[model samples]
Target chain A: MKIQQATLHHLATTESTMDVARNLALQGCPHFTVVVADTQTGGRGRMDRTWHSDPGGLYMTLVLKPDMPAADGLKLTFLASLTLAQTVRRCCDIDAGVKWPNDILVKEKKLAGLLSEMQATGSRIDFVNIGIGINVNNDPARFEPGATSIKAATGATFSREGLLDEFLGALKTGLQNTSLPSVIQQWKTLAVSLGRPVTVVTPRETVTGIAEDVNESGALLVRMSDGDLREICYGDCFHR
Target chain B: MKIQQATLHHLATTESTMDVARNLALQGCPHFTVVVADTQTGGRGRMDRTWHSDPGGLYMTLVLKPDMPAADGLKLTFLASLTLAQTVRRCCDIDAGVKWPNDILVKEKKLAGLLSEMQATGSRIDFVNIGIGINVNNDPARFEPGATSIKAATGATFSREGLLDEFLGALKTGLQNTSLPSVIQQWKTLAVSLGRPVTVVTPRETVTGIAEDVNESGALLVRMSDGDLREICYGDCFHR
Candidate 1:
């Protein structure tokens, strides 16, 4: 659905957008609702991990109802990753690529990431909340060894509102275009893991292989050491 | 951590376990926390969709920390489903089975389901909130066409507290046995989809295949009509 109007919250740095959005969603907020923070004192990523949100960074979460089944919720992560990459490219001249599932990277350094939450009622999806954290103008030194900011890469600072508008616009368009072939093509254009050696780490085991392209269902294709191609449905990929 | 000392809410009815758990979790509640309601007025499954939670039903959500990567958070759904099946058997003396990804079934009717949410800081999973809904002692008329209750199938009325305790006990044991092989074995024993004709419905498309078995990482393996075995990472499965 098209977002007619939205609200923005510029916090000096609060706890987390997920926490805030969860509260709002429970309170019966309308669809396409959004919450953006300047910095998050307790910024978090997927899996309950902490994200350091320095000043001048972009942290936001949008509450939406796509009226889709809960099973298709994973696609929102791909859509968010593509939107973030496109937004980074628009805000800064440097091209940003997506690192499977959700991380957006600029040449191996992380630029942005996304986390999505959905509440399902029986067999149908009720609403989806997509949270994103982008390193727009934050200092690179403030992050871990693998993280990088847009300013650090391109020496440019983008207005957070402008970036949010573009990101949300792209996300709306991406969600509307739900055809598998089209989404896969768009993801391929922004995917950085294709044709690269990557190590997929999971709680059970680790598989190191050459990163083949992603499939229509968003599974990563990895050509294993034994010359057998393995499709990884869910795992964290670490590019070597 | 062992849940030696905990306050368990064994309510005859409530709204939603996720809502109650979120309130408690936000109040700095300790880990191994639990909330069990016999009936939920606003019970939710995934994607914020409503579910039927009549009186004498089982609606609960547990708050816990597994201290793993955020990406492996989906495993909580598997662990919870296993615990649910174990609890249903122990409480009602009826053989219950698990469907891939989430649901627990008994004689072709769904008896229980699971929904998991994780709080992550960057890439590390902090804590996972797993919400489960089971049709315990409710009447058959309370459910939709495809749903089943424990009383309807077994003609038994289970104590809500007894089932909650059993589920929590099984969950604790499962979490302690972090070995993937052991968990997979337990899951396989409780799974009913093995070697069955099932229709897997995804948001993008539907695939009708024979359910083979769950792989090492807890994904369902389906043998398609084209003589190809497809691994379904995530989706809702229905018995045909």
Candidate 2:
């Protein structure tokens, strides 16, 4: 939980920053330790899905020891996304919004993505790695389905280092000052999926509900068709 | 989720099988896969603690995609300890009991220990690795304070493969047939810390209470001196 002990490792190319940061976390790395790679050979997303990691994107992973309950894992993810959205807004003129759970989108197009890994002993969480891969200076056509980078969205290239510094600076301040409720309120302001009808798809089942608000743990509290509140902690969400 | 896809790796020495199995799981390895090392160079316990891994001990980790709720991560740990305790009883003829969250002990001595890792996307759990290390045939003098091997306790050598095969066979059956409720009940039967005065230690605070029972999530339900039931999901427990 010592943010002042932050260490940064910049790599030419690696399989994944998350993998490297994971090894560092295993070696008892302090909180806010970071690993950034120019390119990743084996970047991954949720469910072991492949993440396209070309050279122009920003690939970074931060190792954190929150010393909070297990539910704080969810809160960390939301905190990460909120900072990411804010960074995007500051780095570019476009108003970036967060999709429920972990995606950042601008104008209904995918802008950046996040993946997290948690290592724990029973209920005691040891460390969490928040891996972020943002399409910074790449062509949207390289990735699929409405993906846009800063250049693509604004037609002006931006410095990845500038953006990374901005994002991490904001993150350190946010982590130090913001309460969970306040973080949730800020996230609600930049949320694009809340208050909309949405379909969330899991590997096993699909649930459709009115996307209400997220709880303190960053769980999406959905009011289902049966008037029951379902706090979904996992899934791919599509805003309708 | 495919138990049939179980693959076992037996090695003379490795850093940690949990690290090896985690790589496998990240590469989309199927569930129920296992990694066992005859000797480990760097075994680990919870909260960044080092687990001594000399030769003649059973060091193993199972990579499973339970696809359950996040709380099921706790259930998996209890299930592993319960099965391990049962295997020790069957192989060594000594009663083994679980210490609320992590350690399994025989007659107040440490018999085995467990560590778990969970990866998820949102509320969807991707995979969980429950790593277990047992003092099967090691010299108790080599390990410190309260350590006892099955051979040291019963004065008989037990086959490493034999014990592992037995535990896995029983685990497969237990995972398939027994409900979580039944599993909890079985765990309750082997609980040594329950129904007694205990102290729980977290990073920030300590609490003393009666170890009433664990809930469905394998969280210890402590009846505090304040006459309230506190559901403790994380901490080190000491029985008084």
Candidate 3:
């Protein structure tokens, strides 16, 4: 679907744009539909991490009905992370990079985060709601340490609409390209976690390994201390 | 988690067993948990098809947390379908088999159905709720033309609790076996759709194909008319 064909719903305040986008997807909205909220009362990230969605932050979610296996949906996380970093670089002229799985950072500090949810029947992906939160014009100092926004890092404000447009364009290009290898190559260039010592934690156990590379299925390939390459699917990654 | 540790809340009427199981799963319920209702006010099947959930039918759902990839969860569909067929064969002495993906049939008529829902973060499966419905004593004469219950097929009344026990045992065995190939082989032995002429319909279009073996990913591998093997993840299948 064309990016311009996407309906953009602007909300002054809401619980989450992701929830609203999910409702639209359930109601049979077409692909590439978008939902944006200025303030979210209950914004959340991956692993139930709470995100401070104040007025200056851009909290947006896109409803995509990609005709691919649910496993292939993991590629979208890398696609989105690249788009966010590219948008930050272009809009604010800062060197932005991606952390493994889903965080976008500038100079080893987080500037944005992503959370995606999917509904499926059997192996077919029904629809995926990818929620993107970027600290555009927010003051990260009041939020937490190691969290920095475009405005906080550059000491300049940004237009949420402008940055969102840039991201949607890059995302459209990436989504239309079905070549997983090529998209992953682009992500590897922008990713900062490769070859770094990290700890990955799942609900059951935790493993410390050197971040090697993301496999074809979008799982992180980590080389453990025992010299075994483990594919970690779901976990929290911490740089050591 | 143990099967007996699961408290069976017998309800006279409710919306769905899947909904109740989901609530319990969210509220810190351990694995192998179960919820069974005597009657359902709003029963459902895969693809939003409604099951005749009147009194005498078994409406049940179980929550299982397996440490595996989300893709592996598809095996549970094949697992539950086989379990339902085994339950019917043991209890009613009828030759029951599975229809592709998620339906249990006796002589080409649907005897029971399976619906599985999943919640996850990335590729790790958080918990899966496998909902099953068997038309035990419910008279299907007035229900639908292509449906039959155990009582209608055989002149015998069976206890719902006994059949549930048999199914739970079979399901536990399938869930514990992390080997997907063996589970698929078992399902293949009991599937009626293999090596048959079939029609598959998605929201987009319909295709005629020869039903082939299932792939490693639990998707139906169909040899389409164009001489290509298509792995259909989601669709309605009709045996021609």
Question: Which candidate's DockQ is highest?
Answer: 3
Ranking by lDDT: 3, 2, 1
Docking class of predicted structure 2: acceptable
Please give the distance, in angstroms, between residue B144's alpha carbon in candidate 2 and its true position after superposition.
Answer: 4.8
Q: Tell me the deviation in Å of residue A112 in model 1.
A: 1.2
- Residue-wise lDDT of candidate 2 within A1-240, one digit each (tens)? 112325888898999888899899989888889898888999887667777888788888999887765545666777889999998897787789999888999888888999888866566667878999898898745658768787888888888888888888888878874356677878989999988899998777788999998877567888889999887767788886
Query: Best candidate per lDDT, number?
Result: 3
| B1-240 per-residue lDDT for model 3 (tens digits) | 123535566677889988898888879788888888889988888888887798898898888878877667777777878778877898789989988788889888888888888765566677788888888989865879989889888878888888887788777776777766778788888889999999998767787899897766667888988899987867789999
As for DockQ, the candidate ahead, 1 or 3, is 3
Off by over 4 Å in 3: A1-5, A179-182, B1-5, B179-181
Query: Who wins the TM-score comparison?
Result: 3
Worst 10 residues of 2 chain B by lDDT: B1-10
Q: After superposition, how far is residue A31 of candidate 3 from its true place, in Å?
A: 3.0
lDDT of 2 at B107: 85
- DockQ of prediction 1: 0.08
Please write out the lDDT profile of model 1 over residues B75-142, one tens digit for every residue: 66677788788878877887898888788888888787788776543334456778988887786455
Q: What is the DockQ of each candidate?
A: 0.08, 0.37, 0.44
**Candidate 1: lDDT of A215?**
84
By TM-score, the better pick of 1 and 3 is 3
Candidate achieving higher lDDT, 2 or 3: 3
